[model samples]
Target: MDENQEAWYLWRHVQTQLRVSFGGIVGVDYTALRHVAGILGITLDTAMLHKIQALESVLLKKVK
Candidate 1:
């Protein structure tokens, strides 16, 4: 797959793993993940971050 597609795929996989492992515990601190993504040349933005946060919020609510 192309770079964009690959990045998206990886992001999705990470999101899934995080959801399962953390049980939807989304931390406010995303600097590490964002840095890692940056090093990997993935284009992440505030909006995307918010989406991930939203996913975590939903999951957190479910667990609670």
Candidate 2:
């Protein structure tokens, strides 16, 4: 898959899994997100990164 699609899928997968495992309102941990992104070798823009830091539940439908 393309870079953007892969990023979205991974983000959603982590978000869903975190929520399921935690069994409550769980936000994607910033450190974990960054580590995952690093492993996938994808970079998120400054604005998107800021959003993730401030708004934990933001879903990136498409990266433009």
Candidate 3:
């Protein structure tokens, strides 16, 4: 896959992980997640993170 596609794939994978990790928690702090992503070398902007969180929220709602 190309760079953009690769980024999206990684983002999706991370998002799914975050959803599962935080889905059962009371407060999901995205700042911590973003920091962890950065530490893991995931180059995601705030806008992208916001989009991922939005998508995750939708998925969580559906799964509920």
Best by lDDT: 3
- Compute the lDDT for candidate 3: 0.58
Per-residue C-alpha lDDT of model 2 across residues 1-64, encoded as one tens digit per residue: 6645655555664564343234445556666777777777767678557544444445432211
The C-alpha local distance difference test score for the whole of candidate 1 amounts to 0.57
**Model 1 misses residue 60 by how many Å?**
1.1
Candidate 2's displacement at residue 17, Å, is 6.2
Candidate 3: segments with Cα more than 4 A from true spot: 1-7, 15-42
Give the range of the ten consecutive residues with the poorest summed lDDT in model 3: 19-28
- Using all chains and alpha carbons, the TM-scores for the candidates as numbered come to 0.46, 0.48, 0.45
In candidate 2, stretches whose alpha carbon ends up further than 4 angstroms from where it belongs are: 1-4, 16-23, 47-64
lDDT of 1 by residue, 1-64 (tens): 5635544543554554442334545443466557656777766777666666666576667867
Clashes of 2: 0
> Candidate 1 at 56: error in angstroms?
1.3
- Candidate 2, pairs of clashing residues: none
Assess candidate 1 and give its TM-score to the true structure.
0.46
Query: Model 1 misses residue 51 by how many Å?
Result: 1.3
Per-candidate RMSD vs. true structure? 5.3, 6.9, 4.5
